[model samples]
Target: MMVMVLMIASYSVGSIKVEAAEELDLQAESAIIVDAKTGKVLYEKQSDLKLPPASMTKMMTEYLVLEAISEGKIDWDTTTQVGDYAYGISADPVFSGIGLIQDKDYTVRELYEGMAIISDNATTITLAELVAGSESEFVKMMNDKAEEMGLPEYKFVNSTGLSNEDLGENYPEGTEPNADNLLSARSAALLAYHLINDYPEVLDYSSTMMSELDDQPLQNLNWMLPWEDNNFVPFHFEGVDGLKTGWTQEAGYCFTGTAKQGDRRLITVVMKTDSKEERFNQTKKLMEYGFSQFETTELFEAGYQIQDESTLSVEKGKEEQVELETSEAMEAMVKTGEEDLYELTYEINENNLNENGALTAPVEAGQVVGEAVLQYKGDNDYGYIGGIGTEQRVDLVTTTGVEKSNWFMLTMGAIGNFFSNIFTTVSDAVKGLFS
Candidate 1:
C-alpha cells in the first residue's frame, strides 16, 4: 500500500490551531515572521506595506559580494582600492564608516566583515564598486538580483538602505542619484530567505556581536544575538544569530533577524519601529510567540507500524494482507496544540502490478509496491504539505513475500520438484529391486 500524509497545521483566525494568546500587539509599523526552512508566515502585520529597509539593505550587498566570490569572479584575497567617495565617509561616525582609506586596498574578506559586522556603509560601497564598477551600477545589480529571486517589490536605489535624506537627493545631472531602499516587510523576509538559502556563509559575518578592525572596536548594533545579560543588549532572546539592522530619520528603525531553537529556525522582520529598543523588544516578542505557539512534529517515523485502517488488501499472494509502514522518519512543524499528525491517503499504484486484488505472488520484502504522500487537514501547505513548512518524505517498505499459492501453482511446484525428490526416490527403489 502507498500512503501520503498531508498535515494541515492547527492555526485559525477563529480559534486558530496555533492561535496567539491574544491578538499580538506589536509596536512596529510593519512586521513578519517566517520559518526559514519552509517560508511559512508564522505571523505578519502590514507585511506588504512598502517601507525603507535602512541598513538592512546591506543584505543584498553581502549577497552580491559573496556570490561574486563563489562564482570565481572574485576571491576573498582579492583587494580593492577604496574609492574617494567611500574614503571620504569611511570615518564619518554618523554614516557608520569602517574608516576605509582612499588609495589603500582591503581584501574582499575584510570589507565583507566590516560591512556585515559593523554595518559600515563605506566598506559596503567599496565592495559594491569592486563588483559592479560603481555603487549606482551595483544598485542596478541589486535590483536585478531581487527580480530574479521573485521579489518584485524590492527596489534598490543604493547599496545601503539609507534614505534620501541621509544622503542629499540631488545629484550632478546624468548621475544616478541615491534613493531610499524600499522593500515591504514580506519582500525583506523573502530577500533574507534567498540570501541565507543561497549563501549560508553570510551568517558568519551577520552573527557577530563585537569585533575590531586594526584594534578599533567595531561593536554590533544588533543586540539579540546571545540572548544573555550584558550592557550591550537591551532585550535578550535565545537562538537569534543574524541578518542586519537599519535606522534613519525617515526609515526609523528596522531589523531583519534570524533565530534557531532546536530544529526550528525563524526569519523575522520589523520595519519603521519607533526606537532601537522597541525593535529588539518586538523582535524578541515575535520569536517568543513563534516558539510558544508552534512545534515541530514527526508525522511518521521509521519502523512505524501502520494502523489497521492503513493496511491494504493483497491479491495473488500467499499473504491475505500487507501493511504500509514507514522505513524512515517523516516530520512536520505544526501549531503547539495541534494533535493530528497528518492525513494519510493511500492507494496501491497499479501500474507495476499485473493483477490488483492482493499484491502479486512475486512480492519481495523492501519492494516499493506503493508510495506514501504527506499532507494535513485544512492546510494543503502545512509542514511538508504545500512546500511552506517542514519536509518529510515517506519511504514505503513492504513485508516479506508470501510466495504464490494456487492449485495449479501447487501442481506445477510439485512437478518441478519431482526430479529432485520423487524421481530420486523412484530411481533408488528401482535400483534396489534390480539388485
Candidate 2:
C-alpha cells in the first residue's frame, strides 16, 4: 500500500510537469498571440519591444489607402498623378518600384494593388501623396493614427519603408535622418488587427499568392505562400493565409500571419528571428500550438434569452413587478482541458428599472443592462474567460393594457373625487375670509 501511494504521487507530479511545459511552449522570445474578436493578448513575450518592422510597415500604408477609398477621398477607378518625389524614391536600389511614370496617371485600384500585393515602394508613395497631398504630411497622419490607437512607440517618416536621407527640403541640409517611420512588432500587429477587423476586404488582396501587373507575375513576398519543396514552407500547416513579411539586414526576419478555423481567427507575430526559414517555421509552430491547444466555445447566442424573474419591484408606482432579460450575447475563449470550469454570474440595476420593474423605454429587446462575469472554479491557473449581460424589456401584455382592471376601484375613485371637490371649495372660502 505504501509503494502504491508513492507511485500515485510521483505520477501526479510528473503530469503537472508535462502540463507546465505545454503551457510554456505557447510563448516565444518575441511573439504574441491575440484574439481576433476582442484584441486580447492571449499569450505574449516581449510583445512591446520596439524593433524595426521592415516591409510590415506597408500594412499601415495599405490600410490608409483603403480608408481613403472608402471615405470618397479617392476612388478605385480614379487616376492619381505620380510626382517627382515618388519617382526619385523608386529609383533607389533598395526600394521596390512599380515603374510609376512622372506626371502619368494610374487608377487608384492599380496603385493599391501595386502597394499591397507587390509591396511596391513607388506606388505606395504615389497613393500616399494622392490621399494626403505629400508623404511627409502622410507620415504625420500615420503617427497620429498610432497615437489614437494608443500605440506610443510607432513613428512614421515615410509612407514607404525606404531609408530617409536628411537632404532636408523642409529644413537646411545636414539635419539628422528623420527616425519617424519606425514601428515595433506590437504596433504592426495592431495595424494588422485593425485591417482585418475594419476592412477585411484588404485580405482579398493580401491573401493572393500571385497577381500579374504590367505583364509580370507579382508573386507575394511572404515566403509562407504555398509552394513546392522549399525549406521555407511548412508541410504540415494548412489553411495559412497571407499577411505581411519583412526583412532588412538591420531588422531581421519579421512576419505577421493570420489563420482561421471556423469562426475562430488568430494573429501571430514573430520578429528578429535568425533566418528567413526560422521566421516561417516559428510562425508555423506558434499557429499550430494555438489551434491544437485551444478551442472557441460560444457561451451565449447573440439574442439568446437570459433569466426571467417573476417579481421586480417598482418605486412609487401602481404596478408591482417587472420582467428582466439580457441585451446581447456572450462568448468566451477556453483552454482545451478547462471547458467545464466557467460559470456566468449576473446582477440587475434596481435604480434604472421601470415602475413595473421592467426596463424603461428606449429599451430594445436585446439591450444589455448589467454584466454577467464568468468565474473559474477550476484548480488550473488558466482561469475563466467570458462575460454575461443583464437586460430588461416591457411586458407586452401589460403594456397593451390587456390585463383585467379593478372596476370596484374605479367606482371608489369617482366617489372620492366628488367629496374632495366639496372639501376644496369650503377650504378656499375660509381662506378668502381670513385674507
Best by TM-score: 2
Q: What does candidate 2's lDDT look like per residue over 1-435, in tens digits?
A: 000000000001111112332454522347766666656455566767787777788888888888888898878999877777777766655565556666667888877777777788778878888888877678777777777665636766677665555223531122236453566656676778888888898878877777765666777766666656465456335656758877766668878888877877888888878877777788887777667766676554443333443223433223433344334445555556555555544455445555554543333332334434444454543211111221212211111111223567557766898899999999999999999
What TM-score, over all chains together, does every model reach? 0.72, 0.73
Clashing pairs in 2: 155-180, 156-180, 157-180, 157-181, 322-357, 325-391, 327-366, 327-367, 372-388
Candidate 1: Cα lDDT at 285: 81
Candidate lDDT (C-alpha), each: 0.73, 0.62
User: What local lDDT does model 1 show for residue 316?
Assistant: 51
The local lDDT score (0 to 100) that residue 347 gets in candidate 2 is 51
- Which ten-residue region of model 1 has the weakest summed lDDT? 380-389
Q: Per-residue lDDT tens digits of candidate 1, residues 1-435?
A: 332332222223233455553477999999988888766666788877998888888988888988998999999999988877777667667875767667777888888888988888878878988998887788778888988777746678878766644556322122345556789888888889988888988887788777777567877778887735576456767787798999988789999989889999888899999998888988888888888887776655565654554455665556766666666765555665443635543445565455544465656777665555555554423222122323334656675556667878667766877767977898999999989
